[model samples]
Target chain A: MILTVTLNPTLDKFYWVDHLPLSLERAEEEILIRARKSTASAGGKGINVSIFLACMGVETVAMGFLAGHTGQIILRDLLEKGVTANFVWIEGENRTNVTIIEKGREYHPVKIHEEGPRIPSHAQEIFLRKYRRMLKRAEYVVLAGAIPPGVPDTVYRELTQEAKEAGVKVVLHAGRRPLWEAVKVGPYFVKPDVREELMVGDMPVRTEGEIIAAGKRAVEYGCQACLISHHVTGDVLITPEGIWEYEAKVPLTKFKNLVGADDALVGGVLYRLARGDKLTEAVRFGMAAAVASAEVEPKMCLAPAAIEHEMRAVEVQFKEGL
Target chain B: MKARDLMRRDLTSVEPDTLIYEVVYLMEQSGLSTLPVVDEEGKLVGIITEHDLIHAALPEYFDMLHSISFLPNLNQIQKRLKEMAFRPVSEYMKEVTSVHLDDEDLHIADLLIRKRLKQIPVVDGEGHLVGVIRRIDILSRLIR
Candidate 1:
């Protein structure tokens, strides 16, 4: 079974409007914006991946720190989707992230995120205990998403070390400090969440040359493969053997929603890996899944047939050296 | 606490064509006391509960019996179970009593108490199953 850890989970709520007001300067009085439609679901990088994996008939267990009413909703969603839930309940409510999507501009949704509740130290200890026991059952453990307040930055680093010690492959899918700290432990796979910025430990990945350079730096630290997002429709994969770039044939206009596409990609790759597929093949399938998810209205496309259909549209260009 | 806030949006349901045995298996696996039955279009049609399954397994004269000595052997229940296992969920599904998304908490609680319901399905204007409000879900708020 694959184990996914989402340190900070949220009840993601989306609102669809005809047009989002760019400025309130024209308003003379109070403004009341009406949404055409709305939807809510559980979210967090690891949680999203587990949800995707479960939809594809993969046996996955989602672990995380949950709290209050929103956490209850998140847990219920996981169970409903057939993903086993093992969460550490803490005080305070889980965050509710809101995204406002415009009619024709679904790809560029306005996001409003909340800082999750502070996890108590005792709760962290309990999580470690549960995580240790869960490691026995997990072939791969995904340490993804941001760390909640009151938790140390080295938490993912420690988790990676523990999973490595247990001989379980670790997939470090995080960014900034957490990614930097955990990558030092030599995770099996690294997927940086660079939505906020294109930098990895002071190394800017703005240009193709910079991305390859930063990816190579991660490989030097012993990551089997490091994936970095490029141009919204493509990704750069750096492995010890070589570098490969995957670009989806679909245009930017085809993207309906990109919220959980990255997570779908990660889950798809892990699902194939669990089925004994080679790393490159798994990554190829994962990229297709991401494209499929991005092209759909839902946060993540759960249909295997649709994903397979998108696989043919992915152009894999391999660069043998550098 | 309104029905919209109290109801759990994340839940599992079964299709009407699903076998009784499969429903029971799902209930056992999910540890759910009650399961909603929805049509192909996701419309809330009926519901099945553990109580309903238990009642289905009992002999027709069970309610009339005054003594345990008249009870049948385990073989009788096994036989009944075997026969009912293949039956479709539509055959055993009960008429679902549900609440609208805009309903008040007091109204939902009253319905649950008056009808002795373990859980109440939450539906949209078109009778689509959107969420579920359970007795435990309401009680859980007290501790929180």
Candidate 2:
């Protein structure tokens, strides 16, 4: 079973608008208002990963710190969706993240963010203890997202060390200090977006070579392999065998949103890895999942069929000279 | 099964000009612990409940009045009587969280049970108050 830890889970609220202007007094016309509407769902980085894993018929557990009425709603929703959630209840109400989708505009389509709950120290410790216990049954442990407030950047790093000691393959998807700190513990895999790579390593990754080189450097720092995702260029994976690049596939239909693409990418990569797929195949699957997520509506990830279709079309090739 | 289905469609609400005693009497007659207060356009403005009236009737300084010499008993009794007579229903009314009639699809009864809310006001898309939902209405749904 795969164990996914979401430090700060939330209730996601999606608002669908047609031709939403930045600063507007009123909407003049209907502007081809489709049956487009908003929806609220349980969301967070690790939660999305677990949801996708469950959808793919994978055995996975979602653990996190949830609180109040909103937290209850999230838990209920997750249970209804068939995702096993082992949440540590906190004091404050769980935060609600809002995603605004503009269906008409292609360039500026969706805006996604979270006003995540504040987790106290005691709650953080409870989460860590629960995660430690979960690691005993988990084959792969995925640590995702930034540590909520009151949590140190070294929290994931500590968890990575503990998972390593327990002989579990740990995959970390985080940014900046947490990413930098987690790599030293020698996780099985690390996924960092282009921005995270640049911010953490201070490495200029303009081209594929720069990204691959950065991934190699992370491996050299003790990580088994690294997958760096490029926003417009796609994703690149660096392993002991060589470096492989899987260009992102654009779906035929227009993209409704790109909120959960990163988490989807992690889900895909972990799914393939859990199946014992090679590094290249895992990277390809990860890119396919990312594209599939971008194609779906906000807060609703693409089903397995969409990812499978995208995966079938994805092509990966090795580059020369390491 | 949406919030609109379980919401009270025909509601007798009060305007700002309605007397506090009259509002209390209405609650007593209707067997409601709380009532939704609306404006002339029938838009929900506030809410009045028994808890508010009880709080309003509490003496300002019962502690100090109890320490007075000869007239302590008389003063305390007089204060209690004044509080009961002058207490208004508006002072205790709570502000109901408004819900859009067309937007929400979940059953209002289920939401009330889940959120532990006593009452919820239903409003139109333009924010005009249309109806009110009471706990009894939700209970009746369960019974049926």
Candidate 3:
């Protein structure tokens, strides 16, 4: 079974409105804006990947620090969808992240994310204990998402060390301090979260050459493979074997929502890898899943047939000696 | 606190065409008194409740009778349940009133008291079910 760790989980709520007014005419006036549609789901990077894996008939466990009623909802949603939840309960309530989408500009969404609950030392200890036990049954362990407050930045590095010692492949998906620290541990795979910034470590990813350089730097730091997002429709993969660029031919207008596409890519790749597929084929299939997910309104498309149909649109180019 | 803060955001709902047996299984597993029935777009259409189950199990003529002692056997009720087990929830579920997520706790309490409801579904501006608020939730928050 694959193991996924999401330290901070949230109830992701989305509202689609016809028009989002930037300013109010009067401060005292109560302006009531009705949404055209809305949806709520359990979300966290690892949680999303676990859900995607479960949808593809993969055995996976999602571990994290959950709390209060929102945490209960997150667990229920994961279980109902067939992802095993082994969350350590914390003191405060889990956060609720909101996303506001306008009518025409569905591509650009306004996101308001909460800081989430702090992980008390007791909770952190409990999580580490549970994670250690879970590693025995895991073939691949994915440490994804942001570290909650009160937890040390070395959390991912520690997790990577433990998973590697257990002979489990560790996939580190994060950004900022956690990514910088965990890369030094030489995880099996690395996917930096560039939503906040384009730089991976100190290397800027503003150009294609810079993106490849950053990916190469991660691989040189002892990572077997590193994948970085080149753009919305493409990604760069650097490995000891070679470097490959995977791009979807589909137009940007086809995308309805881009929210969980990255998780789908990772989940799809892990699903294929767990099935003993080659890394090249796995990454290709994962890209197709990402594109398929972006074409739908839901966070990630779970249908196997849809992903298979999308595979025809992905183009893979090989580059050796990068 | 407001409805958004107090309401349970984890929605365990079934589609309108979902079979009765599956709904019962979900309700039994989740310990929910009612499950909201949504359409393809997740718009709340109706709700199936324990009361609805009892209403569906009894025969139309049984409403006029005082006791079940007069019945020959309990097979009649069992047969009724078996018949509707594979049927859709839309046939037996009832339309329900819902509160907005931004609605005040006081307003929700007033509605709960006036309508004698055990729980109320919370919706967004588009009438999509976002959460559920139970009376016990309100009382527990008061104590906390």
Candidate 4:
């Protein structure tokens, strides 16, 4: 069974409209009268990954900080969706992330990211203790996304180190400080976009070659594999066997949202890896999942069919000179 | 057994001024028998139950018609039903009640049962509604 750790989970709300006019009062009637679409789903990087894992018929447990009414909603939604959630109850209200789409127009899409509830020290301690107990049963532990304010960046690093010592493969999907700190403990896999890598290393990745080179450097820094995802260019996979570059083949389609693409990639990669696929195959599947995710409407969990179609079209080519 | 141990953590509450129809929908959606009414400041003010709703569904002249009724008049029934369907929750809800939190002692249950209350609002120290502890919550704990 896979164990996904989301330090900060959220209730994601998506409000969809054909087009959002610049002026509020003038456009209010039209936006409301037109085909208005609104949906609320349980979200957060780890939870999204667990949901996809469940979709793929894998047993997964989502553990994290949850609180208030929204927290109950998250737990209820997870149970209804068949994903087991073991979260530590905190004091404040769970944060909400809203995605406002102007349908096909890129200029009008508004994404409001809220900082999640504060986790008191006692709750944080309880979470660490509970997570350690749960890690005993997990084959793969995924520490994902932004750590809420009160949580130390070293938390993920601590979890990664413990999981490795306990013989559980740790897959980390995070940005900047947490990602940088977790890598020091030698996680099984680290997935970060080019921007995150540049921020952590204080160096820009100007091209595909530089990105691939940077990924290789990440492995040298202690991660078993570094998977670098580039929005337009595709993904670069660096492992002990060598470097493999997978170029995304699917054409850019109408995108609904890009909120959970990284989570989709983590799910895709973990799904294949846990099933015994080689590094190259896992990276290919992961990239396909992400590209497939980016093409769907906002807040839509990546459908398995979308992943399958993208996987069939994905083409990976090896560059010369190891 | 304390109220905290058996109170339903997942509660569906409504504002004191919410429309009765919306409360009915919320009741159906949440599968709850009663709803706690709260003020904007999160203080519990009242509670509404299904029985109160049924009473609110009766004709204004229901008492007058009782002397002659083999069957109530259709117009009166229709008017009563419409009123019941649209009345605000505040109009029908029972105001003022004993409320306790999970951390409170089991003696709170004894006091509530002796007072003939079906339910009590489980509130935090600040008086915000957190959940509701019914007679069943206590009964279940006793059985356990």
lDDT of each: 0.86, 0.71, 0.86, 0.74
lDDT string for model 4 (A1-322, tens) is: 8999988888998877776665667644553424387778788888998988887888788888777788878877876676766666666778898877776763235788889987788667656766776676689999988789888878888999889887999998888778878887789898864433554354456667676776777777778888776555377777766777778765555445666777888899999988999878887888778777777765434577778788876788776434
Query: Can you tell me the DockQ of model 4?
Result: 0.02
User: 2 or 4: which has the higher TM-score?
Assistant: 4
lDDT of 2 by residue, A180-285 (tens): 7888778899887444346436666667767777788887877877887755537777777677777865753556677778888888888898899977787788
> TM-score of every model?
0.70, 0.65, 0.69, 0.66
lDDT winner between 2 and 3, please give it: 3
Which pairs of residues have clashing backbones in candidate 1? none
Model 4 TM-score is: 0.66
Model 4 alpha-carbon drift over 4 Å, by segment: A22-35, A106-108, A193-198, A298-302, A320-322, B1-144
Model 1 chain B weakest 10-residue run by lDDT:
B66-75
Over B1-144, each residue of candidate 2 has an lDDT whose tens digit, in order, gives 556565554344555555566666555544457667765454677877666665554465645665345453566645654655545445556767777766453566566778677888787775655556678766777689
Which model is ahead, 1 or 2, in terms of lDDT? 1
- What are the RMSDs of all candidates, in order? 15.0, 15.3, 16.8, 14.9
Clashes of each: 0, 3, 0, 4
Off by over 4 Å in 3: A25-31, B1-144
Estimate, for each residue in B6-106, the C-alpha lDDT of model 1 and write its tens digit.
87654367778778887776565445789888775557899999889877887888778833366556677678989999999898899989999899888
Off by over 4 Å in 1: B1-144
Contacts from the true interface found in each model, as a fraction, amount to 0.00, 0.00, 0.00, 0.00
TM-score of chain A of each: 0.98, 0.90, 0.97, 0.90
